[model samples]
Target: MTMDTAIARPELLLVADAVAREKQIDREEVLEAMEQAIQKAGRAKYGHEKDIRATIDRKTGDVRLSRWTEAVETVENEETQIPIHIARKFKPDIEVGGHLVDPLPPIDFGRIAAQTAKQVIVQRVREYERKRQYDEYKDRVGEIITGVVKRTEYGNLMVDLGRSEALLRRDETIPRENLHNGDRVRAFIYDVREEPRGPQIFLSRTHPGFLAKLFAQEVPEIYEGIIEIKAVARDPGSRAKMAVISRDSSIDPVGACVGMRGSRVQAVVAELQGEKIDIIPWSPNPATFVVNALAPAEVSKVVLDEEAGKVEVVVPDTQLSLAIGRRGQNVRLASQLTRWDIDILTEAEESERRQEEFRRRSGLFVEALDVDDVIAGLLVTEGFEGVEDLAATPVEELAAIEGFDEGIAAELQRRAEVALERKATELEDKRRALGVADDLAGLEGLSPAMLVALGEKGVKTLDDLADLASDELIEIVGADAMDEDAANAIIMAARAHWFEGEEDAG
Candidate 1:
């Protein structure tokens, strides 16, 4: 057929336009998809080994098919590249890196060729649609999105969010939340990822962020930025805790969130299937924040060990169970909200533990320094927890203590040194008996006790110590005994030999 007959196929352009409008994609991409489909059909008709290509006129919908090869100095691939010498025969001015095109006859839409073209067009269009969906929803992550449950496959719910499908994994759903097809759901778009099948949007109804967004929706103060949700923790369908702070000093953030007659928080609670919510006022002080987080349970005292990131909360005997909650849910959510490891103790338990510690320290001092109970009691009362601290105390510091004369201080110091020496000798014997290496024992940060502990755990050699991660070492030694940075330093010291060996080999 002539160009006039081919141009008569204006229905081709109409199809591209209709598909672009239906798919809500760019018309140019649709045209490109059509061009690719035609090129594929051309390749099927001709030899597949040839570098066949196709193009469609944007306005006229005229389809052109051709075979192209790159002009190169040396043709490595014979089918797709031509030697510069041969390329110059067609165009004398042809140069390397230039393309040479040979037009092919217009393709007749045979049954198989037309089917293959349709498949190519459909596949390419679907790919573009997937990419569009991914781009559209990727930015919506962490925002609240509403969708309808399309279906459930193996406990995973596929939700239709208008343009794309989102996955609500089994674990991400609120506990005890049941849904069937066509159930409307609101969730937090936690993640959007591209996969082999398509763009996968991961939604979560149980995420703490979901609760926060719900509060923002129900409370105008939060949405308007007058109140800020500092942190949220959820038991998901059971209970949740949210900490809020107000930018305006005159505004009460907790009250604003609760609203008049509890209307604001009630809406969020209803959406969460009647999950109890504690709207605590956030504080700049971690202790005060933790105290507020553990509301409905009075806290008498909070002893914070910042180094260990743990808080000891003491409550009255009656409030102990309330503070701990049934199965410890209250304190667990409080810990999550405050970002601290909380240990709840009743007043009686705390007092008993204090007395026990007092006796333990007094006994330790008496045994180590050969002092009387009265003197040891005085040392213990002076805030000495261990003999190591007593021994490390400067003479001036000891003399400053009440009833500690210079001579008494000097005697205490001498006794402390002697006791430590004796303990070290015993630890050294224990370490040797356990076959702990001398090099590991000699490491600066590894005390005699730590060396003995390592030996007991089968980490005797420097190499063995080097093999342990910081967390593993912290596990072996208690968190209070060593922190991540100190443990990492010790591990790096243990690894020094490896580098030395490398230098020696070099």
Candidate 2:
């Protein structure tokens, strides 16, 4: 429509209504945009320094343009403000903060003015649309959305989500899954970001959440919350593992997810481009859950190191390849699903390792306590890990061992204490040789062995220890030596002198 027709005719409101409907924005916003466009043109017709404003009659579509000059005690600019004495001539009751408004006749728009107005309206509408898109989709993150592929740029898919467009980056798409323009696709809304250019909606097909959402859509029990998907891990387009639990005991989680003849799972697999899925039962027990995660392979034994957050799984030799999968894919996905680091070993390998450990610990007891092989083997078999364990054991408890008498237990304890003292003395000598400070040795949590370890790492003084972070201290010593809290305590103790000096200075 021409600018004159747009401003003067009743068709302006109709055009605004149509634009609002088409752009999916509020009708009032379109009217405001039109008002801004008119205001821009009004300033061009009048002086640019004048305070011009424009408003549309929402009901009649009539446009009003006016210059607003504030009634001030003293005029700052002749173009935009008037003195109260002069303003009183136009409005007898005008207040100091009130405006003296003068209505202006509509201007005949030239080609350039019309283009500038159009540009303003277009820019305003785009900004509103972007804001609306951001507000609508920001809360929809982690939801499954379907859209048609609008175009591709640099291997990234620009998807048209009806009212808004979303981006599916190349890495987010399943490997080798080809999508073309105008093709319909489903993806998970991973993020919605407000960027300088516009609101960015990021989509992903390979996200583990995508797989979980797909399963929720396909599985009736999961949708109704009878069965909950605990975790999901994906090697997109190749394989995935989902751990599920059922609140209703009668309904089997794995069997329900699989469906009759695998219909339910097949639907999700089809959407994922034939990625094989293993639906495993979830358990509260970490060992049980880990065993369930490694499906199609029997776990002979599981040794968990809770402090280390690692699990060693012993499987029969025949099940090793299956448990590990091709190129470790099965175990890798299992690890992701369980949130644990897994070390897999064959039955024979685990047996050999256990035997070797038994020999080593037996030899340690034999040498440290000056005991015979039989006695050392008994000590190792009874779970005495070190000379410290022997020294710390009560005489009554030590005598309670099958082969031990009270006299033998007492002698063993004395010998254990002597061995620990000798080890400490050796470590103290090493610590002194490495120049670790005496005050550092006085720290409560640190043993002489740890002091030597710190000295070897060049943390030889209170200042050096104070400067070390807890993680660095843990690393310098050993994870088994102390945990984060103990490390922090020692570091704080090392820093005590600094506070004392500050107090003295004060």
Candidate 3:
């Protein structure tokens, strides 16, 4: 090639513009990459250790190759640096810490030099493309996208998402939804992560947000911010429940989501392969919300245990199966939507349980307090559960019960306290015989009776108590004896001795 042809190739600028437009990156970056590739090829022609640099004009694509050297006070390397005495001959005013540029002849494209340039260009372009993919998709997480199934490996589907490929793992697909190559699919962008191989975009059709997004597209109220999706739970292709509330009192959120004649909901259902959707109105009160979630089956009563995070729902006998759904799906979705554990039962079952609990508490009161059946029944009806509650109650509160005078209340309390004291004395004797450590009794949360119970359960030492987890402690004692928090506190107190030993060792 002639020197003029080698120096400035205008066609190179056209190639750079096309590559930049196709790769969706800056044209300046592609020009820089091309300069580096040409510089490497130039280095292969010249000495590799020399600082050979190449530059391309942005406007004209004029290429220039040069070798750079620093003018130092002391002569170091003869190839790149020159002494000031020698540099002054060329510049006539050379100074230390200044750079000198020496022009080099244009490289003749040998086979190996051309191959090296091609490799550098390809590598740099691929890096830029991967980075572009990462930057573009990172902020698009939680968005819904459409794609075509490119191929399947095992059960994973590689989808062509226009700009890049995305992964739809087998477990993230809707259940029993058989997708083939070239099939169009819509999925939610759950995650965008950069891996060693490349930027991975993970899509999911079974994500609960997928249903919410579909609703947002179909329901104008949701898109307009008049209605909000409170929560969503999906059993994927079988059934799904969504809770929605309206910011405006004038609009019915559930009705708006259902659309006119169920057109909006039907659209979502068609996309989900006929997954049943229940649009329920959201309520701040968990009990009311749970009642709404277990719809199509009437709830007769809902008893909530807030501390335990459980709700008991009572339905009619005929509606039990419907309330629980096929294979317990309805109740499971209700529990997830309400963020509470649900126990469903028929009205008859609840009534029978109530009677059994009444009889059990009545029998215990009668035997422990030496009271008659009528007095025991009265105490149980007044909602007193145990001897401890009776003994702890004030005389006035006890007398407030129907058919009980102040004198009878005082007598009942005295008897309850005496029985409890005798029981404590006997338990103390047993605790001593079991070799329970005395330090465990000093724990703040443990009462004398609770300590005795722990002794019986073989939690003898402080280490023993500390070694047991909170759940294990709660199990050793009755569920009503303590909550998980109190159990954790007691165990921590027992573990304090370990910290003291650690400090001593330190």
Question: Which regions of candidate 1 fall more than 4 Å away from where they truly are?
Answer: 1-7, 394-400, 403-407, 421-443, 446-506
- 1-506: candidate 1 lDDT, tens digit per residue: 43332333567889989998999888888889988988888888888888899888877778788889999998799989999999999988988999898888888889999999999999999999999999898898899999999999999999999878999999998888898999999999999999989999999999999999998898888889999999999999999999999999999998988999999889998998899999899999999999999999999999999977999999999998899998899999999999999999999999999999999999999999999999899999999878788889999999999888989998998999999999999999999999999978888887888888888899989999999999999888777788889999999999998899789989
| Full-model lDDT for every candidate | 0.91, 0.93, 0.91
Per-residue lDDT tens digits of candidate 2, residues 1-506?
Answer: 22342255478899999999999999999999988998999899898999999989888887878889999998778888889998999899999999987778777779999899999999999999999999999999999999999999999999999999999999999999999999999999999999989999999999999999988898889999999999998999999999999999999999999999999999999999999999999999999999999998899999999978999999999999999999999999999999999999999999999999999999999888888999999998999889999999999999999989999999999999999999988998999999998988988988888998999899999999999999999998998889999999999999999889789989
Per-candidate TM-score against the hidden true structure:
0.89, 0.93, 0.90
For candidate 1, the C-alpha RMSD (Å) to the true structure equals 3.2
lDDT of 1: 0.91
lDDT of 3 by residue, 1-506 (tens): 43442376899899999999998888887888898999999888898889899999888888889899888889778777888878878887778978788778888778898888888988888888889899999999999999999999999999998879999999999989999999999999999999878899999999999999999998888999999999999999999999999999999998999989999999999999999999999999988999999998899999999989999999999999999999999999999998999999999999999999999999998888888989999999998989889999999999989999999999999999998999889888887888889998778888777777888888999999999999999988778989989999999999998899789989
Report the lDDT of model 2 for residue 456.
88
Candidate 1: residue 217 Cα off by (Å):
1.7
Which scores higher on lDDT, 1 or 2?
A: 2
Models ranked on lDDT: 2, 3, 1
Whole-model lDDT, model 3? 0.91
Candidate 3: residue 389 Cα off by (Å): 1.8
Comparing candidate 1 with candidate 3, which one achieves the higher lDDT? 3
